[model samples]
Target: MWFSALSALWLAATAWAAVDRGEDGNIRSIALRTHTLKQPYLDSDMSSRWYDFGGDTVIRTDSYIRLSSDRPSQNGWLFSRVPLTATNWEIEVEFKISGKNQLYGDGFAMWLTKERGQLGPVFGHTNNFEGLGIFVDTYKNNRPGTVFPYVMAMVGDGKTPYNKDNDGKETEFAGCSARGIRNANIPTKLRLTYFQDKSLKLELQYKTEDEWLLCFETNEPPTIPSVTYLGFSAETGELSDNHDIISIDAKNLYTTAGSSTPSKKTPGRGGASKLAKQKEGGSWTWFFFKIIFFILAIGGGYVGWTAYRTNQKRSHRF
Candidate 1:
């Protein structure tokens, strides 16, 4: 009996240790190809959605989403309903600059936010550009001295705007150079990773069939809450510019604990809430299992030592 209990404890510890650290957190993704968008509608995969501020938009190739900013006040937004909580996650997409003009305003961005559903060029105009936005800037209006083809991760609430010209303290997260990914011609892949422990990393890469070249990396971390919806948007003012999204993939890194176990709660209108509760319960179960295993290991070790001592005593008497 003791041996069996010890073996079970050892197996339990091993199983817990073998749990994949980088599991995709059971995140579900949506593809943008199946859904069609009207001119003013948002483009979305089944998992996430997008919205445009009124303009001529069309689905060109089955995989590519296109927008035309003929109207001066045109803007586009693709947002997800997921709330921003403190968790680890990642968002990646492919973007290309289709057409260009003199004042193309701001091109587009990958946003993780909790802003009230008003979408437009939140970077140049207002203080509500809060949360985080990875901006691909075509127009150098914000940074007059700099040339085109730049990327930046904008953080902080939409209440403060980062001044591109000033070095210190105009905005929260400032712009960075993405000279490698900007081709004005070809497409490039952008990826952002957020750790629940307040660590954020950004990577811009050029993708080819055989390999991916990493363009830019940042030492700074993302300054947003844990759980937030991941999405994209674009805006244009005077100078006409259009940004196209080829694809998007997002994964939630934080999984609720004990998700595998069944719950006793009566399922009702609060299905989502109940599901969340079950996840929390699963986490507790995992924790409890770990504690039990530890206790068993200690007890088994003591018993084994006692048996060894008893055997030694018998041999000495003989």
Candidate 2:
């Protein structure tokens, strides 16, 4: 069994060693509809059950969810109502951005944040966010040695603000310049994958239909919020573009070999901290159980001794 497990790991590593930093072909995953949105997005009452929309967001049942159209000072958002409880997960977002003008400013963002459905300067969401933000920037703010329509990730700590002038140059942890990402023939899509304390990777599917090009991967994932919410937000200033989200496929990735603990969290709880608390609680339970067993054992021993004494007395009487 050990040998088989080692071989499986070796094969997965070898697959990742390929030219493209695509997903490990052997990895197992299941789609999570709680974090997914597609065509005919809204329910019968013209409201989405799993997601919430805000700002100037417009929902078209037959087509896409238009976050913002080709107009100036536009802001729109789509945020999941529930928190993502999976320990490890992947989110694939299909979207399109296009405009008649040669110039376009602002862009969109994919988020796993503690603060959702809030509006601000950071791509229709708030600054000083409490989780992960992957910005698909269409305009070049002031990034040197990089081009526009870039993809960058930032992990916010709820205190530091996003530098709109510097285009998040201050707090960005991982990023890549995705040229021609604003308007792609195959429709631009990005896949963000995160494994707790392991790795966080982003891939783009703009070049071809099925080919996913790697944007970046970091071995040490940033500190994610204990209870994260899925969200997408977009904003446009003077330069405008039509930003639309066609479909979204969210999945919870896990390995079959080991049991994947769901990251169930309350307001004051966290993942690792909660696990530690559970362990501590279990130890106390066992400690009490052992004491009870010891007491029961002594009680049985005393009862047996008393019966033996009574038997001896009865025998003498006989």
Candidate 3:
């Protein structure tokens, strides 16, 4: 049994090693786009690779492409200049949303559509698109029982309106509420994987410090036509936030392993601050607090008992 396990591991490792990863460690991708979003003339320098549409969208040197802010009625989109040519592709992006308004909203979106810069109702873009729309909905447009910061996906056939009142429950192919994503101490990571006609998977790390949580996966045939562009859009209505995309890494999967299944580290791992994990979920600090609280409670009881005993002894002496 041990020999068989070792052999299996060896075989998998060998197969992985056989694939060619170029000098940049990018495997089999025909086109790779990586941007830190930190140049003075970013819009110009990236004009050939990216385009910004709508209002109040700015590229900041501090490390993000700002889509929209707390400003009401603000809407914008940043799109890829070139189409996603690869049949199987993966895109990883680090993003965060923070601003005033405790009841923040209209959220953000990531798109793989046949068209670009078309704005309408679906998170600042036109509805009925002919591709995939991944919504990182921050506010509760509807659905009272559901939590905020819901992440959902919809395949557009260029017709159906995303039922926002139901929180897209009607149109949503798959979705889940991802708490701790907005204003996370560390940027949340969003990874999307589409393997041709096989499957589409979405993973979200509420906090950069945590492991990727598989939000949802669907095997339904994508209603989207050939994806021509990739981009992000955001809007603000009564509520708002600073929707920012820190960085994006897009890669073609077909080149790396022809018709191969998705790998364990499909989008690769992230290096985030350890302290950030505490903000999202319980950590060593939680245990430490429990221990300290227990000790303090015991000490308080002991002190009270000692004082009471002393008072009784004094009264007896009297």
Candidate 4:
């Protein structure tokens, strides 16, 4: 019986050791949230400090970033300066496309690449139409007169043309059904998750006041192992539309064969200190285990005393 109890304890310890706790520990840095287009750009107005491109190409209106098109190849982008070296991570954002008379352009994209700083919409769409364009295509292109906007991901290394005449061979990643939500009607949330084991997952949910629905999902994984930078981008040609990005939060996990560590980066938001507080909540499990050990110790002591009493009575009788 004692041997079995010892074996159970050893198994429990082994199981506990295998659990992943990458998000624990102190944070390295936390940036104050700021709108990408705040006037005067005061430190207090900074909610999410975005790496804004096009200067006045974007505006904060009605609780989102509005990217407008005033030129032939107008583009807007915001990215964190942090390096995402972790093997596994999650990136999510809330986006809404509004306004009318928008045509012939790629929508918004969340990208992870080694290239530093901003790469404009020309680098985004290959041959002026395709490259790595995770396009929330608002206007009809391949399918004409379709009210449903399609979600597509375009990918290529470069070797492509830069004109509408060339339909570049950029790989299309995912798409959504465009029946329910109109282009200017409702907001949607898009989430992309990369696992350490080379599995990439994508999910899109329609935003609501209470909850979001998992409208689309995919199991296709990323070919690359490590991505240096992560950010969002949008482009408009003749027809103009705006993508209002509400929030973006990411949790990066550093893992090897033996150990794992998690670091979180939330752009334009604050929550790192709260995560530290939650780490303390995990200690209750250890306390519960200690209590169980104490109870077992007391029970063993009682059993030993009972055995001693029995031996003493037998000896006395003899």
Candidate 5:
């Protein structure tokens, strides 16, 4: 009986060790197909890869994708169709936030998660969600002396609620408050890197010097499940900003199966895996709206030109 018990314990330890470390003492490296989000409406192919939610969100000027409007109580979300199937990967994003004036409330969140479009009080997506969330909070929800425009990260286990009242201090795994993330001369950049061995690192380019500031690194196992979605969400209470996502680059850092870790294979035939297939709605309305918006914009430009010409002629006569 003692021998049997000892064998069981040994088996459990071996399993834990396997899950806790990378293959061959290091995570395998891989190359992933890049998905770029820019201009002329999200392509139908990209529509197949990305999901947009909320009324105020839109793609504008054939390039920038606006995630939210500068309106109170408004919220918006965009999720990638691709799932981070591999254990080790990196996602980099270039984004900008601007508004007519200074006041901005709530903030924006970038997520690598098991949940999609689940809206709630925390940054437009649900709290207690499974996976990791990196938030660029633009408003100060805490006391008078606290910093504004904070960047923070939280890892969830699908059961713990984020402490929204205290600005996530209670639930934050790691974070930093960056003052100039919004309205910068150059777009703000963030990179998230995760390894199978459980090191999660974040780098930020909040200034124009082209340097990456290390926010924080943690050794905790990314409690998120194997299959997860990549998404962004934003919310506004009394204040708001025009949150624009310029680009997103997701790269798989580990090699496909047949390496030392043959058990963990890339999803599907490609290095990137599609978000678990979900029913998508028609895009005719979106198509028509884009057409009308462009038409009106052109007409408005013509009218302004004609008016300016008339004024110039009158001035010459005088």
Candidate 6:
């Protein structure tokens, strides 16, 4: 019995120690390949198994995906063919926006919507979308006193149209000004993290290398549905800029397996509320303690087994 218990504890401890951890000892989240996009973006057949790029979008096998060039009246987009079913996930996008003209109008958007491959008025994509839209607006339209290059988030209920006239002021709920996002020398990046019916956060990496600045994080985020497609779109008007997406990497948070996600919620009649839940604050102290206790159990079992063997030998001699 002692030997069996010690053997089991030793195996359990070995498995626990083998988990992947960073130099800082933090556990890395699992990557979801279905939603992740990176180099060698397309297959040899000149097509992606997971994505579809359309309109003015040009795929450069050697480098980035040019969503829209520095020309007027250009609109382009890239969308994932399958829905991102992960309930808690983080998506990081590396991109660049550059133009020759001193004045640049229009901008790009990142979307998680129920529908995909639709072209409409809102940021060159379809209006009345059923999920989240993160608009990176470079041009200042209306709303005096606010800064340009604003990053705003809006949740649509599939009925309300985006307020394009004044730059979506009516529908936007959370946002912040990101002035240095355009024309950056270093690699510019944006990270969007969402927990379904929970929190949502956006971070920017435009100023320096590997330094992420929080654009927005909310505990009471607008309710986002569990199933949604990931997509990116950009538009260029009279004043144009080159909207290039270098890469996209998406990862799942919490437990790796998608089976642990919360059940999908049916959308309300014509509105998505602003009462999202936040991930419960906790720590892994108990997990660490469990490993420690198992190690101690193994040691105790070995000691007991040795004593039992000695007693049996002495008894046999007597």
> What TM-score does each of the candidates earn?
0.55, 0.73, 0.69, 0.56, 0.67, 0.75
As a TM-score, model 6 comes out at: 0.75
Q: Cα RMSD (Å) per model?
A: 14.5, 15.4, 19.4, 12.5, 25.2, 8.0
List ranges where model 2 is wrong by over 4 Å.
1-26, 258-318
lDDT per residue for candidate 5 within 206-233, as digits (tens), equals 7865788888776664566788888888
lDDT-based ranking, best first? 2, 6, 3, 5, 1, 4
Task: Tell me which of candidates 1 and 5 scores higher on TM-score.
Answer: 5
- Global CA lDDT computed for model 6: 0.81
Record all residue pairs in model 5 with backbone atoms less than 3 Å apart, i.e. clashing.
28-254, 29-254, 29-255, 30-253, 30-254, 39-62, 39-63, 40-62, 49-81, 81-275
lDDT of 3 by residue, 1-318 (tens): 434654675676577556645322333543464322223426445553354555568876656778897788888888776677777777888888898667888899999888788777778888878888999998786687888789988888877778877778888788888888887877688988777777788999866576889998766546556646888899888888989887777776653322244333333342232233334335444765675567557767777898999999999999
lDDT of each: 0.56, 0.84, 0.73, 0.52, 0.72, 0.81
Evaluated at residue 74, the lDDT of candidate 6 is 88
Model 4 worst lDDT run, 10 consecutive residues? 27-36
What residue pairs clash in candidate 6, if any at all? Answer: none
lDDT by residue (127-166, candidate 6, tens digit) is 9899999999999889787898999999989999988778
Candidate 5: where are CA atoms >4 Å away? Answer: 1-31, 34-36, 44-55, 143-146, 255-318
- Segments of candidate 6 deviating more than 4 angstroms: 1-28, 255-318
lDDT of 5 at 202: 88
Q: Identify the superior model by TM-score, candidate 1 or candidate 6.
A: 6
Model 4, 1-318: lDDT tens digits are 765776787788787655555334322222223212233322355444545444324655446554544344556766556556655666667677665543444455665655434556542322322223445655454554435466655454545433322222235555555443335345566666665544555566664443544433444443542545565666766665666566666655444443333323347444755554465545656786896688689768978998999999999999
Name the TM-score of candidate 2: 0.73
Clashes (candidate 3): 3
Top candidate when judged by lDDT against the true structure? 2
Candidates 2 and 3, the one with greater lDDT: 2
Where in model 3 is the C-alpha error above 4 Å? 1-31, 34-48, 208-210, 255-259, 262-318
lDDT string for model 2 (1-318, tens) is: 434654675675566344231234234677898999999999999999999999999888998998888999999999999999888888889999888899996899999999989999999999989999999998987889887788899999999999999898988898998887877888788988888887888999888888889899877789797799999999999999989999999887776443343332457666566577567547755875676567557767777898999999999999
| 1 against 6, candidate with superior lDDT | 6
Predicted model with the maximum TM-score? 6
